[model samples]
Target chain A: MANAVLTVRGIVRSFGAFRAVDEVNLDIIEGEIHALIGPNGAGKTTFFNLLTGSLPLTEGEIRLRGEVISGLPMDEIARRGIVRSYQISSIFPDFTALANVRFALQRKRGANFDFWRSERSLESLHGRALELLDELGLVEWADVRAGDLPYGRKRALEIATTLALDPQILLLDEPTSGMGREDIGRVVDLIRKVSKGRTVVMVEHNLSVVEGLCNNVTVLARGRVIASGSYKDVASNEKVVEAYLGAAHA
Target chain B: MAGTAFLKTTRTAGVSQSQFLGFTKARAIFFLLFAALIAVGPQFLYPIFLIKVYCFIIFACGYNLLLGYTGLMSFGHAAFFGMGAYLCGYAATQWGLPFELSVLAGTVIAAAMGLVFGWIAIRRTGLYFAMITLALAQMVYFIAMQAPFTGGENGIQSIPRGTVLGFIDLSSNTTLYWVISVIVLAAVAFYNRIIHSPFGQVLRAVRNNPERAKSLGYNVDRFKLAAFTISAAMAGFAASLKTITFGIATLTDVSYVISTEVVLINLVGGIGTIFGPVVGSFFILSLEHFLAPYGPWVLLIQGIVFTVFVLLFRQGIVGELQKRFRTHL
Candidate 1:
């Protein structure tokens, strides 16, 4: 906890009578790829939403670099270096892959309000956007519309946009969801490469991906964290086995 | 071969760089042609009809800023347009303000209305947003009906054409025509600048995906509010110009019918394209002018035209042209 870049304590999100995320606690250390895994209806996405400020928490505190950001708006939270990507492919469909990245860079550079200047004048930002696309192996897809890209490439483009923000902490919800095995492997590698020198808290359903990439894993079941530790430790935990892996195998 | 090569070289050399105020070389040429048309238009066409077309073109362009670019369909734009007319008329008649200041007053008032209405309405989206705007516009219509300075049902009539900049007596039709043409052209150019600016990019991004734009650290509501205010201000500018041209501000200008008409104009022209509103304004205005003698049949004809456009040319005339040409017209 001493090196924790993001700390979530007693985070609770209740929808009417249903407690979607109940009293969760987590500590994400700097430069760690931490995974949140759970069976369907186990509150993984809700917990992710709570952490990203996409949903209001019923009760809890979220601190980023020791600053309380529990109730801040999503954009404000992103501005404070906690950016998130959706479980679905969330890149702007109509925008070219290059433009998708440039928009994020534009926000990072505080050039969003430059209404009088030509968009071409923002060409300086394109270098960085292209760099991000190149980093994600999307340089070939740069001019292609994000919506027109194949599913795997669209996920990669989404990551490229997320990276453009230069976030200190990145939350990715199901970054490899709906991808084929080959695409999944590519994205797993993409995530590992991009997590260098940055903190990532991802909601991943692929156990192999978690084992291969995550430094630590948190298992949630019935809206509560049932186990948390190294992948080996949490995977073998009797409660996690009973609640998630047991159900998966059954 | 040498002669052909020389011709090609000269053509390329004569082509202007695409960096002139964000317009491409082709677009710049198109703009020049457009300017020429505007310059010579009044001579051939009915000058008064041309003035009306320009006013609606400005109004539709302003409406498009929100509906077309920002993806917000406001059904209450007449509130801004009508407010501009009434406010400008009042300023000219009551305060005896010059032409320019009266227009300025109208524009500022409409912008202020936009700020307030946008704040309240942007909390909702889609049909809810449209309905809120429609309700607010109706409230404005009621205010216009009962307000004493607005001349009630009779409306503000016979507004004087005050001198521009304390000179250039606007009494002459030709002089006023030139002035309106210049103002309309400048506004269109300004709109073009905005559509190609970083702010416009962000607005489009917000329109495409509000959630993604927010995740990128943009305050989406703030951007929407800004677009709404700017759109309202432009609509107000158009309204004031119309009032000055006709020397009257009527309740019909602020009515719900006017709001729907502007939406129709944008739809018929092209919702998001830069010149769509201009094409739509001319098309609709020409229809109205030509069908004036048809009496009640005009409404039937207009309805049929709208239905056909929606069914066959939903992207609109300009949108269809842009699609076919593979260019951003």
Candidate 2:
């Protein structure tokens, strides 16, 4: 197997007695689209939050490139090359698409503390931001406010902004959750294109996108990993099918 | 969506594309006109009145740096303002320091206060943040009322104007007026530079979506604290100037009423717009000047005006003009 780019070892998260994420372990390989799928309320989002340092872990540790990052703050974690996209399509809605990307680029360039320099003087960042926008096919919407973009386009912009961070690992929570079929296809293609040189860990609900795009799959049920393997191996696993059917019946 | 619509309409309206040191041409013109007025102001208006307006203008601008651009509503700004006044007053009167040194001391103290208050306040957000700041300010107010150096209830009074540098006597009101004008204009210009800089972009991003900013790897708390400290320092500068101009520091300066008054001024002048605070300061101060003869009726008139502005002019004078003319100022 290829070396794991991100390692989550025996991670546990609890809310009082609930145990939202219980003793979960994950090893995401470098340059692979790793799918983390589970039934509803399987603690997928909680696990994602723990990995990204948005929520403190109840137990266990997460490491990126062999360095422990389990308890660092969200921004600190992000600076170490782990960036994420929200399930709700988070973007700076008031800013223009270009400005949103430019903000990301500014952070990537470590210019967040540059109070004395005019924003206009950062022409290199503008060019790079535009290139990123164009890469996402959002060049036409460059000047448009993100809040005014349609839902799918907003999702695309979120990914573009995330891309501007030049992250080593992209943790996307439901990147194509609320999209139409065409939009889903477009995002799937976009994800495929962008995930070429980086590791991707996505908690996705759409089974087909997972089957088509993901090289490996991890099936989670009741906050436990039921199955982990290639898509074909995991999809045909008895426990994985039972968990999905059981969730549907319940 | 509403914010996007508002921005679209305003941005499309003849907004000047050219900027000199972050001031759009319209804003530059506004500043030029303001300077001209300052140069000729004392002949037509009371020098003290103009100084009062200038002080509040600085205060409001500093307040707007936090509440307007950063979307952090602080209800304890008077703590910094009053502390500046009291500290500068005490330094000048007790230690017999020069005007410049006292003002510098006051600004440093205010920045320290901002650091402590901002560190605590930023731990919470929205109403909780506002309440915490308000609580902190009240604590400072009580401290001021008891602290011996602050002169207790009477405050530090009869602070000397002192000589600027080693020679330029500021006993002359006109001389003091010119000094204040230069300081205030420079401060405003500096503020303009800040809001147009890369840091300001990050601040706006934090205001727009803090979580998103964090995910982008910007230390949101640190940025917020920096802005808070700068704002507090500016507020302190204004208060020191006020103390120097009036030669006194009083309880009224630090009261919660002053805090609310600054908020109202920012709101009436357009909270986020660059020139809104200046316009609001002038408008409110003018109202006060005109209504001063009416006794307690002045408060009633001010309330009525505030109500009318809130209902009819949501953006304030400069904001409305910006909307109409498509210019930032």
Q: Listing candidates in order, what is each one's chain A TM-score?
A: 0.95, 0.95
Question: Which 10-residue window in model 1 chain B sums to the lowest lDDT?
Answer: B7-16
Cα error, residue A168 of model 1, in Å, equals: 0.9
lDDT of 2 by residue, A10-128 (tens): 99998999898999988999999999999999898888899888999999999988999999999999999999999998999988887888788888777666777766655556666
**TM-score for candidate 1:** 0.94
* Candidate 1 clashes between residue pairs 3 or more apart in a chain or in different chains: none
Recovery fraction of native interface contacts for candidate 2: 0.61
Candidate 2 CAPRI assessment class: acceptable
Weakest lDDT window of 10 consecutive positions for candidate 2 chain A: A118-127
Candidate 1 global lDDT: 0.87
> lDDT at B215 for candidate 1?
85
Error of 2 at A109 (Å): 1.6
Instruction: Give one digit per residue, the lDDT tens place, for model 2 in B173-272.
Output: 9999998999889888888878877888888889999988988888999999999999999989999999999999999889998898898899888988
Per-residue lDDT over A1-250 for candidate 1, one digit per residue giving the tens place of the 0 to 100 score: 8999999999889899999989899899999999999889999888878877789999989998899999999899888888888888898888888889888988977767677887776666766777777777777667687889998888888988998998988899999888888778877887888789899999988899999999999999999999999999997788888886576653
Q: After superposition, how far is residue A67 of candidate 2 from its true place, in Å?
A: 2.1
